[model samples]
Target: MNPTWNAIRSGLERGVIELRQTFTTAQDLWGYLFPAVVLLVVMTVMRDSEVPGTGFSLGAMALPSVLGMNVAYGGLVNIAQHLAVEREDGTLLRAKAVPGGMLGYLVGKIVGIAGAVLVSLVLVLVPGMFLFDGLALTGVGTWLGLLGVVALGLVATMPIGAALGSLFPNARSIGLLFLPIIGLIAISGIFYPVTSYPEWIQWIAQAFPIYWLGLGMRSALLPEALVAAEIGESWRHLETLAALGAWAVVGLAVAPIVLRRMARRESGSSVAARREKALQRVA
Candidate 1:
């Protein structure tokens, strides 16, 4: 058997094992459920309110945007978190020591993270469909569009996460990423209309994959009449694809180079040093 094929198979098995662990482990289960509960609560609180220019429930308008934000959020943060922690713990070094181990490691991480993203989506979408009044869950096209948006969102974000992870000196450094991410979410209109922002801010938001992902999700899930509340009274599926596809291309191009460089730098001594620093911080 080809070594690459062997690595892929091993990676798939690892991914499945980790995905199964998501259901079994207390921390993983909490990670999924807590956010869902919070989002549900907030949406419920806003159930009676309306979008700025439309009679649609503000909660309903937000449901799909929040769902799309989840995909982007999890893809970027989870993968980066896992990579940072694992690198500090010597996992990357161990993988680097083996034939095609780095490839297998990445594949497993992507699969596991993607599966986790889907689980998060379902936890929200299943309940939101019942609670939210304006969702267009009645057709095959809507469902297919949702899936397409999700796939593209994952592709756009995960590789960038990997690249960022490789740059982090330790797991604690991941905390610094949060403030910027929060700012992005704020402007991306996860819970409000992007059109409400100034034209300059709106242009900045539209430049990123997060905004496009949220737009795609809204396009798939919200009623056609809700377009009036959007920036240009349109879903602009083509613009969504172009923006996300550009991100996908850039991430795919950069991550492999960065990961390879990071892999080359990983050594047992480096891992041990990082562990020592982490312990000293604890002490």
Candidate 2:
């Protein structure tokens, strides 16, 4: 077998193992379910309210948007967090020691994260379909568009996460990323429509992938009439594709170089030195 293919297969197996593990333990299951539960609670609270001028349930509108946020968030933050924690724990160094192990490691991470995200979508989407009344879940087009958006979102985000993870010295610093992500989510219209926001805020929001992810998802699941709540009163499918594609291109281009650099630096001594630094800081 070709060495690269073997590595990818190994990674896929590893990913499957990790994906299963997430659901087995109480803590792991809770960790995965906690955010979903919170979002559901929020949606429940908003269920009584209506979108401005539409009489559509505000909570219904938020369902797809929140799904989008979950996909993008998992792809970007989960991978980065894993990478950082793995690096600190010397798992990355172990991968570095094996031929094509880094490739396999990345493949595994993608698979594991993608599986988890898909499960999350199903968990949230299924319950939401019953709880909400306005979702457009009746067509093949709806399903296809959703699949496309999710695939694109993962491609656009995971590499960037890997690249960012390569830059961080430790997992603790990843908390800093949370604030900016929250800020973006606030402006990206996950909880509400972006069309009502000021144009400048709209422009800023549109510049990032999270907004497009939310928009793409809304385009997929929301009714055509609800387009009134969207900017330009259209789904702007082409723009969502273009914006997400740009991010994918950049992430794909940069992640390899950064990962390689990080791997090259991950000698035993370097890991020991980093561990020493952490211990000394704690002391």
TM-score for all models, in order of appearance: 0.99, 0.98
lDDT of 1 by residue, 114-140 (tens): 999999999999999889887899899
Candidate 2, residues 1-283, lDDT tens digits: the string is 9999999999999999999998898987887788888898899899999889899999999999999999889888989999998998899999988999999999999999999999888888988989899899998999999999999999999999899988999988989889999999999999988987999999999998999999999999999999999898899999999999999999999999999899988988888888898899999
Specify the poorest-scoring 10-residue window by lDDT in model 2: 28-37
Best by TM-score: 1
How many clashing residue pairs are found in candidate 1? 0
TM-score for candidate 1: 0.99
What's the lDDT of the predicted structure labeled candidate 1?
A: 0.92
Model 1 residue 92 lDDT? Answer: 89
Give the lowest summed-lDDT range of ten residues in model 1: 201-210
The count of residue-pair clashes in candidate 2 stands at 0
Alpha-carbon lDDT, every model:
0.92, 0.92
